[model samples]
Target chain A: MKNRLKVLRAERDWTQAELAAALKVSRQTINAIEKGKFDPSLPLAFKAARLFELSIEDIFQDEVTP
Target chain B: MKERTTEAGDFTACNVKNNVRLLSWVFAWVVTLVLADKAELYEWHSSAFISIAAIVINAAIGLGVIVVFMRHLKGLDELQRKIQLDALALSMGVGLVGSFTYSLLVTAKFVIDAEVTDIILLMTLTYVVGVIVGQVRYR
Candidate 1:
Protein backbone atom coordinates (compact mmCIF):
# COMPACT_ATOMS: atom_id res chain seq x y z
CA MET A 1 0.00 0.00 0.00
CA LYS A 2 1.05 3.55 -0.73
CA ASN A 3 0.07 6.43 1.53
CA ARG A 4 0.07 10.18 1.65
CA LEU A 5 1.14 10.20 5.29
CA LYS A 6 4.34 12.11 4.60
CA VAL A 7 2.52 14.74 2.61
CA LEU A 8 -0.25 15.02 5.17
CA ARG A 9 2.16 15.30 8.08
CA ALA A 10 4.15 17.89 6.19
CA GLU A 11 1.01 19.89 5.52
CA ARG A 12 0.20 19.94 9.22
CA ASP A 13 3.80 20.64 10.22
CA TRP A 14 3.75 17.45 12.32
CA THR A 15 6.92 15.50 12.76
CA GLN A 16 6.87 11.69 12.74
CA ALA A 17 7.35 11.66 16.49
CA GLU A 18 4.41 14.02 17.02
CA LEU A 19 2.19 11.95 14.75
CA ALA A 20 3.31 8.77 16.50
CA ALA A 21 2.56 10.35 19.87
CA ALA A 22 -0.92 11.17 18.67
CA LEU A 23 -1.41 7.61 17.45
CA LYS A 24 0.15 6.00 20.51
CA VAL A 25 2.74 4.25 18.36
CA SER A 26 6.50 4.40 17.95
CA ARG A 27 8.08 6.88 15.55
CA GLN A 28 9.66 3.92 13.77
CA THR A 29 6.20 2.67 12.98
CA ILE A 30 5.25 5.96 11.44
CA ASN A 31 8.50 6.06 9.51
CA ALA A 32 8.00 2.53 8.25
CA ILE A 33 4.46 3.32 7.17
CA GLU A 34 5.54 6.49 5.40
CA LYS A 35 8.37 4.68 3.69
CA GLY A 36 5.98 1.96 2.48
CA LYS A 37 7.95 -0.71 4.28
CA PHE A 38 5.22 -1.62 6.72
CA ASP A 39 1.46 -1.66 6.59
CA PRO A 40 -0.67 -0.53 9.51
CA SER A 41 -3.20 -2.78 11.10
CA LEU A 42 -6.89 -1.96 10.78
CA PRO A 43 -7.28 -0.18 14.08
CA LEU A 44 -4.14 1.88 13.48
CA ALA A 45 -5.27 2.75 9.96
CA PHE A 46 -8.61 3.83 11.36
CA LYS A 47 -6.86 5.89 13.98
CA ALA A 48 -4.81 7.60 11.31
CA ALA A 49 -7.94 8.27 9.28
CA ARG A 50 -9.63 9.78 12.29
CA LEU A 51 -6.62 11.94 13.02
CA PHE A 52 -6.53 13.23 9.46
CA GLU A 53 -10.30 13.70 9.29
CA LEU A 54 -10.28 11.56 6.15
CA SER A 55 -11.29 8.07 5.13
CA ILE A 56 -8.75 5.28 5.00
CA GLU A 57 -8.83 5.29 1.26
CA ASP A 58 -8.09 8.96 1.25
CA ILE A 59 -4.89 8.35 3.14
CA PHE A 60 -3.74 4.91 1.94
CA GLN A 61 -4.21 3.78 -1.63
CA ASP A 62 -3.83 0.18 -2.65
CA GLU A 63 -1.36 0.01 -5.48
CA VAL A 64 -3.32 -2.63 -7.42
CA THR A 65 -6.87 -1.53 -6.77
CA PRO A 66 -9.27 0.96 -8.38
CA MET B 1 -7.37 15.80 16.70
CA LYS B 2 -7.27 13.98 19.98
CA GLU B 3 -5.20 15.80 22.57
CA ARG B 4 -1.80 14.28 23.27
CA THR B 5 -2.19 13.07 26.81
CA THR B 6 1.34 11.80 27.42
CA GLU B 7 4.93 11.92 26.30
CA ALA B 8 5.78 10.84 22.78
CA GLY B 9 7.33 7.55 21.61
CA ASP B 10 6.95 4.03 22.96
CA PHE B 11 7.98 4.57 26.55
CA THR B 12 4.66 5.33 28.17
CA ALA B 13 4.37 5.28 31.95
CA CYS B 14 2.55 1.93 31.91
CA ASN B 15 5.18 0.48 29.59
CA VAL B 16 8.02 1.73 31.77
CA LYS B 17 6.35 0.26 34.84
CA ASN B 18 5.86 -3.10 33.20
CA ASN B 19 9.45 -3.07 31.90
CA VAL B 20 10.74 -2.44 35.40
CA ARG B 21 8.58 -5.24 36.76
CA LEU B 22 9.80 -7.63 34.09
CA LEU B 23 13.42 -6.67 34.68
CA SER B 24 13.08 -7.25 38.42
CA TRP B 25 11.40 -10.60 37.90
CA VAL B 26 14.14 -11.71 35.48
CA PHE B 27 16.81 -10.58 37.91
CA ALA B 28 15.17 -12.48 40.73
CA TRP B 29 14.86 -15.56 38.60
CA VAL B 30 18.56 -15.47 37.67
CA VAL B 31 19.63 -14.96 41.28
CA THR B 32 17.44 -17.77 42.52
CA LEU B 33 18.73 -20.10 39.81
CA VAL B 34 22.36 -19.32 40.61
CA LEU B 35 21.82 -19.72 44.34
CA ALA B 36 20.02 -23.02 43.89
CA ASP B 37 22.72 -24.36 41.60
CA LYS B 38 25.51 -23.30 43.96
CA ALA B 39 23.75 -24.74 46.98
CA GLU B 40 23.27 -28.07 45.24
CA LEU B 41 26.83 -28.13 43.93
CA TYR B 42 28.36 -27.32 47.34
CA GLU B 43 25.96 -29.54 49.29
CA TRP B 44 25.06 -26.51 51.36
CA HIS B 45 21.75 -28.16 52.30
CA SER B 46 21.69 -31.91 52.93
CA SER B 47 17.94 -31.76 53.44
CA ALA B 48 15.65 -32.38 50.48
CA PHE B 49 13.32 -29.75 51.90
CA ILE B 50 15.79 -26.94 51.26
CA SER B 51 16.29 -28.10 47.68
CA ILE B 52 12.54 -28.28 47.16
CA ALA B 53 12.12 -24.82 48.60
CA ALA B 54 14.76 -23.46 46.28
CA ILE B 55 13.07 -25.08 43.30
CA VAL B 56 9.67 -23.72 44.33
CA ILE B 57 11.03 -20.21 44.75
CA ASN B 58 12.84 -20.37 41.46
CA ALA B 59 9.68 -21.56 39.70
CA ALA B 60 7.60 -18.83 41.25
CA ILE B 61 10.03 -16.17 40.12
CA GLY B 62 10.13 -17.69 36.63
CA LEU B 63 6.35 -17.56 36.51
CA GLY B 64 6.44 -13.94 37.57
CA VAL B 65 8.86 -13.19 34.75
CA ILE B 66 6.54 -14.82 32.23
CA VAL B 67 3.50 -12.94 33.50
CA VAL B 68 5.26 -9.59 33.54
CA PHE B 69 6.68 -10.19 30.08
CA MET B 70 3.23 -11.00 28.74
CA ARG B 71 1.77 -7.86 30.24
CA HIS B 72 4.60 -5.80 28.84
CA LEU B 73 4.04 -7.26 25.38
CA LYS B 74 0.31 -6.58 25.61
CA GLY B 75 0.92 -2.96 26.45
CA LEU B 76 3.32 -2.44 23.54
CA ASP B 77 2.33 -0.95 20.24
CA GLU B 78 1.34 -3.38 17.46
CA LEU B 79 4.65 -3.24 15.63
CA GLN B 80 6.62 -3.83 18.77
CA ARG B 81 4.36 -6.67 19.78
CA LYS B 82 4.73 -8.30 16.37
CA ILE B 83 8.49 -8.02 16.57
CA GLN B 84 8.52 -9.55 20.03
CA LEU B 85 6.23 -12.37 19.02
CA ASP B 86 8.36 -13.10 15.99
CA ALA B 87 11.50 -13.13 18.09
CA LEU B 88 9.82 -15.42 20.61
CA ALA B 89 8.84 -17.80 17.86
CA LEU B 90 12.35 -17.84 16.51
CA SER B 91 13.77 -18.52 19.95
CA MET B 92 11.32 -21.33 20.55
CA GLY B 93 12.27 -22.88 17.26
CA VAL B 94 15.95 -22.64 18.07
CA GLY B 95 15.40 -24.17 21.50
CA LEU B 96 13.54 -27.14 20.14
CA VAL B 97 15.88 -27.74 17.24
CA GLY B 98 19.03 -27.29 19.26
CA SER B 99 17.85 -29.60 22.04
CA PHE B 100 16.80 -32.38 19.67
CA THR B 101 19.96 -32.11 17.61
CA TYR B 102 22.09 -32.28 20.72
CA SER B 103 20.15 -35.25 21.95
CA LEU B 104 20.69 -37.00 18.64
CA LEU B 105 24.39 -36.31 18.71
CA VAL B 106 24.68 -37.60 22.26
CA THR B 107 22.72 -40.74 21.48
CA ALA B 108 24.91 -41.39 18.46
CA LYS B 109 28.03 -41.05 20.64
CA PHE B 110 29.27 -38.17 18.48
CA VAL B 111 29.20 -35.72 21.39
CA ILE B 112 29.36 -35.92 25.13
CA ASP B 113 28.81 -33.94 28.36
CA ALA B 114 26.23 -31.57 26.95
CA GLU B 115 23.74 -29.63 29.10
CA VAL B 116 20.33 -28.00 28.63
CA THR B 117 21.81 -24.63 29.56
CA ASP B 118 23.84 -24.60 26.36
CA ILE B 119 20.68 -24.90 24.28
CA ILE B 120 19.03 -22.21 26.37
CA LEU B 121 21.96 -19.87 25.75
CA LEU B 122 21.73 -20.52 22.03
CA MET B 123 18.04 -19.73 22.07
CA THR B 124 18.65 -16.55 24.00
CA LEU B 125 21.26 -15.40 21.53
CA THR B 126 19.00 -16.23 18.62
CA TYR B 127 16.12 -14.30 20.21
CA VAL B 128 18.29 -11.26 20.76
CA VAL B 129 19.50 -11.37 17.18
CA GLY B 130 15.95 -11.73 15.91
CA VAL B 131 14.77 -8.74 17.90
CA ILE B 132 17.69 -6.65 16.69
CA VAL B 133 17.03 -7.60 13.09
CA GLY B 134 13.35 -6.81 13.42
CA GLN B 135 14.05 -3.45 14.99
CA VAL B 136 16.60 -2.55 12.35
CA ARG B 137 14.35 -3.67 9.53
CA TYR B 138 11.41 -1.68 10.79
CA ARG B 139 13.51 1.33 11.57
Candidate 2:
Protein backbone atom coordinates (compact mmCIF):
# COMPACT_ATOMS: atom_id res chain seq x y z
CA MET A 1 0.00 0.00 0.00
CA LYS A 2 1.07 3.51 -0.77
CA ASN A 3 0.33 6.07 1.88
CA ARG A 4 0.73 9.81 2.29
CA LEU A 5 1.73 9.30 5.92
CA LYS A 6 4.97 11.24 5.49
CA VAL A 7 3.22 14.21 3.96
CA LEU A 8 0.52 14.20 6.60
CA ARG A 9 3.08 13.95 9.35
CA ALA A 10 5.03 16.82 7.83
CA GLU A 11 1.91 18.97 7.57
CA ARG A 12 1.26 18.38 11.25
CA ASP A 13 4.94 19.02 12.04
CA TRP A 14 5.00 15.72 13.91
CA THR A 15 8.10 13.59 13.97
CA GLN A 16 7.83 9.86 13.46
CA ALA A 17 8.36 9.40 17.18
CA GLU A 18 5.47 11.75 17.93
CA LEU A 19 3.13 9.95 15.56
CA ALA A 20 4.25 6.61 16.92
CA ALA A 21 3.56 7.75 20.46
CA ALA A 22 0.13 8.98 19.41
CA LEU A 23 -0.58 5.62 17.82
CA LYS A 24 0.96 3.63 20.69
CA VAL A 25 3.49 1.98 18.40
CA SER A 26 7.25 2.10 18.20
CA ARG A 27 8.86 4.80 16.11
CA GLN A 28 10.37 2.17 13.84
CA THR A 29 6.89 1.04 12.80
CA ILE A 30 5.97 4.56 11.73
CA ASN A 31 9.25 4.86 9.88
CA ALA A 32 8.67 1.57 8.10
CA ILE A 33 5.15 2.60 7.10
CA GLU A 34 6.32 5.97 5.85
CA LYS A 35 9.09 4.39 3.85
CA GLY A 36 6.72 1.77 2.44
CA LYS A 37 8.84 -0.98 3.95
CA PHE A 38 5.75 -2.42 5.59
CA ASP A 39 2.00 -2.22 5.23
CA PRO A 40 0.14 -1.75 8.47
CA SER A 41 -2.62 -4.10 9.55
CA LEU A 42 -6.22 -2.98 8.95
CA PRO A 43 -6.75 -1.90 12.53
CA LEU A 44 -3.48 0.00 12.55
CA ALA A 45 -4.29 1.63 9.23
CA PHE A 46 -7.64 2.74 10.60
CA LYS A 47 -6.02 4.06 13.72
CA ALA A 48 -3.54 6.06 11.66
CA ALA A 49 -6.32 7.48 9.51
CA ARG A 50 -8.37 8.34 12.58
CA LEU A 51 -5.45 10.03 14.27
CA PHE A 52 -4.82 12.17 11.20
CA GLU A 53 -8.53 12.90 10.83
CA LEU A 54 -8.53 11.56 7.29
CA SER A 55 -10.36 8.79 5.49
CA ILE A 56 -8.39 5.59 4.96
CA GLU A 57 -8.61 6.04 1.22
CA ASP A 58 -7.30 9.57 1.56
CA ILE A 59 -4.22 8.28 3.36
CA PHE A 60 -3.60 5.03 1.52
CA GLN A 61 -3.95 3.85 -2.06
CA ASP A 62 -3.29 0.61 -3.88
CA GLU A 63 0.05 0.48 -5.65
CA VAL A 64 -0.04 0.70 -9.39
CA THR A 65 2.26 -1.45 -11.54
CA PRO A 66 3.16 -1.10 -15.19
CA MET B 1 7.04 -3.52 -1.39
CA LYS B 2 9.89 -1.22 -0.64
CA GLU B 3 13.27 -2.52 0.50
CA ARG B 4 13.35 -4.16 3.91
CA THR B 5 15.46 -2.08 6.25
CA THR B 6 17.05 -4.74 8.43
CA GLU B 7 19.74 -3.79 10.87
CA ALA B 8 22.15 -6.37 9.59
CA GLY B 9 24.92 -5.30 11.91
CA ASP B 10 22.73 -5.72 14.95
CA PHE B 11 21.54 -9.09 13.73
CA THR B 12 25.10 -10.23 13.20
CA ALA B 13 26.05 -9.10 16.66
CA CYS B 14 23.20 -11.05 18.17
CA ASN B 15 24.17 -14.15 16.23
CA VAL B 16 27.77 -13.84 17.33
CA LYS B 17 26.72 -13.50 20.93
CA ASN B 18 24.63 -16.65 20.73
CA ASN B 19 27.45 -18.58 19.11
CA VAL B 20 29.84 -17.53 21.83
CA ARG B 21 27.40 -18.60 24.50
CA LEU B 22 26.95 -21.99 22.83
CA LEU B 23 30.69 -22.49 22.64
CA SER B 24 31.01 -21.62 26.30
CA TRP B 25 28.38 -24.21 27.16
CA VAL B 26 30.22 -26.91 25.21
CA PHE B 27 33.48 -25.97 26.89
CA ALA B 28 31.87 -26.21 30.32
CA TRP B 29 30.48 -29.66 29.55
CA VAL B 30 33.82 -30.87 28.19
CA VAL B 31 35.62 -29.58 31.27
CA THR B 32 33.14 -31.35 33.54
CA LEU B 33 33.56 -34.62 31.63
CA VAL B 34 37.37 -34.40 31.80
CA LEU B 35 37.29 -33.69 35.52
CA ALA B 36 34.96 -36.62 36.13
CA ASP B 37 37.20 -38.95 34.12
CA LYS B 38 40.44 -37.83 35.76
CA ALA B 39 39.20 -37.93 39.35
CA GLU B 40 37.52 -41.35 38.89
CA LEU B 41 34.33 -39.59 39.99
CA TYR B 42 32.35 -41.92 37.67
CA GLU B 43 33.11 -44.85 40.02
CA TRP B 44 30.96 -43.61 42.87
CA HIS B 45 27.57 -41.89 43.48
CA SER B 46 29.47 -38.60 42.97
CA SER B 47 29.13 -39.19 39.24
CA ALA B 48 25.42 -38.43 39.46
CA PHE B 49 26.15 -35.33 41.50
CA ILE B 50 28.56 -33.96 38.89
CA SER B 51 26.24 -34.81 36.03
CA ILE B 52 23.27 -33.14 37.70
CA ALA B 53 25.33 -30.08 38.58
CA ALA B 54 26.48 -29.72 34.98
CA ILE B 55 22.95 -30.08 33.71
CA VAL B 56 21.62 -27.54 36.19
CA ILE B 57 24.30 -24.99 35.34
CA ASN B 58 23.75 -25.37 31.61
CA ALA B 59 20.00 -25.01 32.04
CA ALA B 60 20.46 -21.86 34.09
CA ILE B 61 22.74 -20.34 31.49
CA GLY B 62 20.37 -21.26 28.69
CA LEU B 63 17.44 -19.68 30.51
CA GLY B 64 19.47 -16.57 31.15
CA VAL B 65 20.32 -16.24 27.48
CA ILE B 66 16.64 -16.67 26.58
CA VAL B 67 15.63 -13.98 29.04
CA VAL B 68 18.16 -11.55 27.64
CA PHE B 69 17.09 -12.26 24.09
CA MET B 70 13.44 -11.73 24.99
CA ARG B 71 14.28 -8.41 26.60
CA HIS B 72 16.05 -7.30 23.45
CA LEU B 73 13.09 -8.42 21.36
CA LYS B 74 10.80 -6.26 23.47
CA GLY B 75 12.53 -3.28 21.90
CA LEU B 76 11.67 -4.39 18.37
CA ASP B 77 9.02 -2.87 16.09
CA GLU B 78 5.71 -4.49 15.23
CA LEU B 79 7.05 -6.17 12.11
CA GLN B 80 9.89 -7.72 14.08
CA ARG B 81 7.49 -8.80 16.81
CA LYS B 82 5.28 -10.51 14.22
CA ILE B 83 8.31 -12.25 12.74
CA GLN B 84 9.44 -13.43 16.17
CA LEU B 85 5.99 -14.73 17.03
CA ASP B 86 5.70 -16.57 13.74
CA ALA B 87 9.14 -18.07 14.25
CA LEU B 88 8.33 -19.21 17.79
CA ALA B 89 5.04 -20.77 16.64
CA LEU B 90 6.86 -22.62 13.88
CA SER B 91 9.47 -23.83 16.34
CA MET B 92 6.83 -25.18 18.69
CA GLY B 93 4.98 -26.95 15.88
CA VAL B 94 8.13 -28.52 14.50
CA GLY B 95 9.34 -29.53 17.94
CA LEU B 96 6.06 -31.23 18.75
CA VAL B 97 5.99 -33.21 15.52
CA GLY B 98 9.62 -34.22 15.85
CA SER B 99 9.16 -35.34 19.43
CA PHE B 100 6.05 -37.35 18.53
CA THR B 101 7.83 -39.00 15.62
CA TYR B 102 10.74 -39.98 17.85
CA SER B 103 8.38 -41.41 20.42
CA LEU B 104 6.59 -43.42 17.72
CA LEU B 105 9.87 -44.74 16.40
CA VAL B 106 10.91 -45.81 19.88
CA THR B 107 7.58 -47.50 20.50
CA ALA B 108 7.80 -49.38 17.19
CA LYS B 109 11.33 -50.50 18.03
CA PHE B 110 12.61 -48.76 14.97
CA VAL B 111 15.28 -47.18 17.16
CA ILE B 112 16.97 -49.17 19.87
CA ASP B 113 17.31 -46.22 22.18
CA ALA B 114 16.59 -42.52 22.41
CA GLU B 115 19.17 -40.43 24.17
CA VAL B 116 19.40 -36.91 25.60
CA THR B 117 21.65 -35.95 22.69
CA ASP B 118 18.92 -36.95 20.24
CA ILE B 119 16.41 -34.71 21.94
CA ILE B 120 18.88 -31.81 21.98
CA LEU B 121 19.56 -32.24 18.27
CA LEU B 122 15.83 -32.28 17.55
CA MET B 123 15.35 -29.02 19.44
CA THR B 124 18.27 -27.40 17.67
CA LEU B 125 16.88 -28.47 14.33
CA THR B 126 13.50 -27.04 15.25
CA TYR B 127 15.03 -23.67 16.11
CA VAL B 128 17.04 -23.60 12.88
CA VAL B 129 13.94 -24.43 10.89
CA GLY B 130 11.96 -21.78 12.68
CA VAL B 131 14.54 -19.10 11.98
CA ILE B 132 14.73 -20.06 8.35
CA VAL B 133 10.97 -20.03 7.97
CA GLY B 134 10.66 -16.72 9.75
CA GLN B 135 13.26 -15.09 7.54
CA VAL B 136 11.65 -16.44 4.39
CA ARG B 137 8.15 -15.43 5.40
CA TYR B 138 9.16 -11.94 6.38
CA ARG B 139 11.23 -11.45 3.28
Candidate 3:
Protein backbone atom coordinates (compact mmCIF):
# COMPACT_ATOMS: atom_id res chain seq x y z
CA MET A 1 0.00 0.00 0.00
CA LYS A 2 1.05 3.53 -0.77
CA ASN A 3 -0.12 6.61 1.03
CA ARG A 4 0.12 10.41 0.77
CA LEU A 5 0.82 10.62 4.49
CA LYS A 6 3.99 12.64 4.01
CA VAL A 7 2.23 15.19 1.83
CA LEU A 8 -0.77 15.39 4.14
CA ARG A 9 1.42 15.76 7.16
CA ALA A 10 3.47 18.42 5.43
CA GLU A 11 0.38 20.34 4.40
CA ARG A 12 -0.90 20.27 7.96
CA ASP A 13 2.51 21.39 9.23
CA TRP A 14 2.43 18.33 11.44
CA THR A 15 5.45 16.24 12.30
CA GLN A 16 5.25 12.48 12.32
CA ALA A 17 5.26 12.57 16.11
CA GLU A 18 2.34 14.97 16.17
CA LEU A 19 0.41 12.81 13.76
CA ALA A 20 1.30 9.75 15.79
CA ALA A 21 0.18 11.48 18.97
CA ALA A 22 -3.16 12.39 17.37
CA LEU A 23 -3.56 8.82 16.13
CA LYS A 24 -2.25 7.32 19.43
CA VAL A 25 0.74 5.64 17.80
CA SER A 26 4.50 5.76 18.11
CA ARG A 27 6.65 8.19 16.17
CA GLN A 28 8.53 5.23 14.76
CA THR A 29 5.29 3.86 13.41
CA ILE A 30 4.51 7.12 11.64
CA ASN A 31 8.02 7.24 10.25
CA ALA A 32 7.77 3.68 9.00
CA ILE A 33 4.43 4.39 7.33
CA GLU A 34 5.78 7.50 5.62
CA LYS A 35 8.87 5.64 4.47
CA GLY A 36 6.75 2.81 3.07
CA LYS A 37 8.52 0.40 5.36
CA PHE A 38 5.34 -0.71 7.04
CA ASP A 39 1.69 -0.72 6.08
CA PRO A 40 -0.89 0.59 8.51
CA SER A 41 -3.85 -1.45 9.60
CA LEU A 42 -7.36 -0.64 8.36
CA PRO A 43 -8.31 1.21 11.52
CA LEU A 44 -5.08 3.17 11.46
CA ALA A 45 -5.63 4.06 7.83
CA PHE A 46 -9.13 5.24 8.68
CA LYS A 47 -7.78 7.30 11.55
CA ALA A 48 -5.29 8.95 9.24
CA ALA A 49 -8.03 9.67 6.71
CA ARG A 50 -10.19 11.20 9.41
CA LEU A 51 -7.31 13.30 10.65
CA PHE A 52 -6.62 14.58 7.14
CA GLU A 53 -10.32 15.20 6.50
CA LEU A 54 -10.06 12.96 3.47
CA SER A 55 -11.40 9.60 2.45
CA ILE A 56 -9.24 6.52 2.85
CA GLU A 57 -9.07 6.09 -0.91
CA ASP A 58 -7.69 9.58 -1.23
CA ILE A 59 -4.91 8.89 1.27
CA PHE A 60 -3.98 5.33 0.42
CA GLN A 61 -3.91 3.14 -2.65
CA ASP A 62 -3.48 -0.59 -2.92
CA GLU A 63 -0.84 -2.02 -5.18
CA VAL A 64 -2.06 -4.76 -7.53
CA THR A 65 -0.10 -7.96 -7.19
CA PRO A 66 0.72 -9.85 -10.34
CA MET B 1 9.46 17.24 12.32
CA LYS B 2 10.83 18.62 15.56
CA GLU B 3 8.33 16.70 17.58
CA ARG B 4 9.22 13.52 15.70
CA THR B 5 12.86 14.01 16.44
CA THR B 6 12.16 14.59 20.11
CA GLU B 7 10.00 11.50 20.40
CA ALA B 8 12.61 9.42 18.64
CA GLY B 9 15.23 10.76 20.99
CA ASP B 10 13.05 9.99 23.98
CA PHE B 11 12.57 6.44 22.78
CA THR B 12 16.29 5.97 22.35
CA ALA B 13 16.97 7.34 25.79
CA CYS B 14 14.37 5.10 27.34
CA ASN B 15 15.88 2.07 25.62
CA VAL B 16 19.31 2.99 26.91
CA LYS B 17 18.03 3.44 30.43
CA ASN B 18 16.33 0.06 30.30
CA ASN B 19 19.55 -1.60 29.16
CA VAL B 20 21.46 0.06 31.95
CA ARG B 21 18.99 -1.10 34.56
CA LEU B 22 19.12 -4.66 33.24
CA LEU B 23 22.90 -4.69 33.21
CA SER B 24 23.11 -3.21 36.67
CA TRP B 25 20.77 -5.81 38.09
CA VAL B 26 22.75 -8.63 36.49
CA PHE B 27 26.00 -7.23 37.80
CA ALA B 28 24.66 -6.80 41.30
CA TRP B 29 23.32 -10.32 41.41
CA VAL B 30 26.52 -11.83 40.09
CA VAL B 31 28.66 -9.87 42.53
CA THR B 32 26.50 -10.86 45.48
CA LEU B 33 26.57 -14.50 44.44
CA VAL B 34 30.32 -14.53 44.03
CA LEU B 35 30.91 -12.78 47.33
CA ALA B 36 28.61 -15.11 49.18
CA ASP B 37 30.26 -18.15 47.61
CA LYS B 38 33.75 -17.00 48.52
CA ALA B 39 32.75 -16.15 52.07
CA GLU B 40 31.27 -19.62 52.53
CA LEU B 41 28.05 -17.95 53.53
CA TYR B 42 26.11 -21.05 52.54
CA GLU B 43 27.84 -23.04 55.24
CA TRP B 44 27.21 -20.48 57.98
CA HIS B 45 24.70 -21.26 60.70
CA SER B 46 22.56 -18.22 59.70
CA SER B 47 22.88 -19.10 56.03
CA ALA B 48 19.16 -19.68 55.64
CA PHE B 49 18.30 -16.24 56.99
CA ILE B 50 20.93 -14.59 54.83
CA SER B 51 19.72 -16.45 51.79
CA ILE B 52 16.14 -15.40 52.47
CA ALA B 53 17.20 -11.81 52.90
CA ALA B 54 19.12 -11.89 49.66
CA ILE B 55 16.13 -13.32 47.83
CA VAL B 56 13.87 -10.62 49.24
CA ILE B 57 16.26 -7.87 48.22
CA ASN B 58 16.59 -9.25 44.72
CA ALA B 59 12.83 -9.53 44.38
CA ALA B 60 12.34 -5.95 45.49
CA ILE B 61 14.93 -4.70 43.01
CA GLY B 62 13.43 -6.72 40.21
CA LEU B 63 9.94 -5.43 40.97
CA GLY B 64 11.16 -1.86 41.04
CA VAL B 65 12.86 -2.21 37.69
CA ILE B 66 9.83 -3.82 36.08
CA VAL B 67 7.48 -1.20 37.48
CA VAL B 68 9.60 1.63 36.11
CA PHE B 69 9.82 0.01 32.72
CA MET B 70 6.07 -0.64 32.62
CA ARG B 71 5.26 2.95 33.59
CA HIS B 72 7.24 4.22 30.62
CA LEU B 73 5.53 1.73 28.32
CA LYS B 74 2.07 2.78 29.51
CA GLY B 75 2.29 6.01 27.53
CA LEU B 76 2.90 4.22 24.24
CA ASP B 77 0.52 4.72 21.32
CA GLU B 78 -1.58 2.11 19.55
CA LEU B 79 1.16 1.03 17.16
CA GLN B 80 3.62 0.77 19.99
CA ARG B 81 1.15 -1.24 22.02
CA LYS B 82 0.54 -3.59 19.11
CA ILE B 83 4.23 -4.11 18.59
CA GLN B 84 4.80 -4.74 22.29
CA LEU B 85 1.94 -7.20 22.51
CA ASP B 86 3.15 -9.07 19.44
CA ALA B 87 6.64 -9.22 20.85
CA LEU B 88 5.44 -10.46 24.22
CA ALA B 89 3.30 -13.14 22.58
CA LEU B 90 6.23 -14.33 20.54
CA SER B 91 8.43 -14.42 23.62
CA MET B 92 5.87 -16.38 25.59
CA GLY B 93 5.41 -18.92 22.83
CA VAL B 94 9.11 -19.41 22.31
CA GLY B 95 9.91 -19.51 26.00
CA LEU B 96 7.25 -22.11 26.62
CA VAL B 97 8.54 -24.36 23.88
CA GLY B 98 12.13 -23.95 24.99
CA SER B 99 11.29 -24.72 28.59
CA PHE B 100 9.22 -27.73 27.61
CA THR B 101 12.01 -29.10 25.47
CA TYR B 102 14.49 -28.65 28.28
CA SER B 103 12.16 -30.43 30.67
CA LEU B 104 11.76 -33.29 28.23
CA LEU B 105 15.47 -33.59 27.84
CA VAL B 106 15.94 -33.65 31.60
CA THR B 107 13.32 -36.32 31.97
CA ALA B 108 14.96 -38.45 29.29
CA LYS B 109 18.33 -38.08 31.06
CA PHE B 110 19.75 -36.42 27.97
CA VAL B 111 20.93 -33.43 30.01
CA ILE B 112 22.34 -32.91 33.46
CA ASP B 113 21.13 -30.47 36.07
CA ALA B 114 19.61 -27.36 34.55
CA GLU B 115 20.47 -24.40 36.74
CA VAL B 116 18.63 -21.13 37.32
CA THR B 117 21.13 -19.39 35.05
CA ASP B 118 20.10 -21.69 32.20
CA ILE B 119 16.43 -20.72 32.58
CA ILE B 120 17.28 -17.05 32.83
CA LEU B 121 19.40 -17.25 29.69
CA LEU B 122 16.58 -18.99 27.88
CA MET B 123 14.14 -16.24 28.81
CA THR B 124 16.60 -13.55 27.76
CA LEU B 125 17.05 -15.27 24.43
CA THR B 126 13.30 -15.47 24.07
CA TYR B 127 13.00 -11.70 24.50
CA VAL B 128 15.79 -11.07 22.00
CA VAL B 129 14.07 -13.33 19.48
CA GLY B 130 10.76 -11.60 20.11
CA VAL B 131 12.26 -8.18 19.42
CA ILE B 132 13.84 -9.46 16.22
CA VAL B 133 10.56 -10.98 15.08
CA GLY B 134 8.63 -7.81 15.82
CA GLN B 135 11.10 -5.65 13.91
CA VAL B 136 10.98 -7.94 10.90
CA ARG B 137 7.21 -8.29 10.92
CA TYR B 138 6.46 -4.62 11.33
CA ARG B 139 9.10 -3.54 8.87
Top candidate (DockQ): 1
Docking class of 1: medium
Indicate the residue-level lDDT of B92 in model 3. 75
Over the stretch B76-97, how does candidate 2's per-residue lDDT look in tens digits?
5567677667777777776778
Candidate 1: which pairs clash? none
In candidate 2, stretches whose alpha carbon ends up further than 4 angstroms from where it belongs are A1-38, A41-57, A61-66, B1-53
| Residue range with the least summed lDDT across 10 consecutive positions in model 2 chain A | A20-29
**Could you tell me which residue pairs clash in candidate 3?**
none
* Candidate ranking (DockQ, best to worst): 1, 3, 2
Model 3 residue A18 lDDT? 77
Which wins on DockQ, candidate 1 or candidate 3? 1
For candidate 3, write residues B84-130 as lDDT tens digits. 77777777776778788888999899989776568668777777777
Q: Where does candidate 1 chain B have its weakest 10-residue lDDT segment?
A: B1-10
TM-scores for the candidates? 0.93, 0.53, 0.65
Q: CA RMSD for every model?
A: 1.9, 7.8, 4.6
Q: Which candidate is the best by TM-score?
A: 1
lDDT tens per residue, model 2, A6-64: 99989988776677767666566777788887898889889988888999999999998
Candidate 1, which segments miss by more than 4 Å at Cα? Answer: B1-11
Chain B TM-score of every predicted model: 0.90, 0.58, 0.65
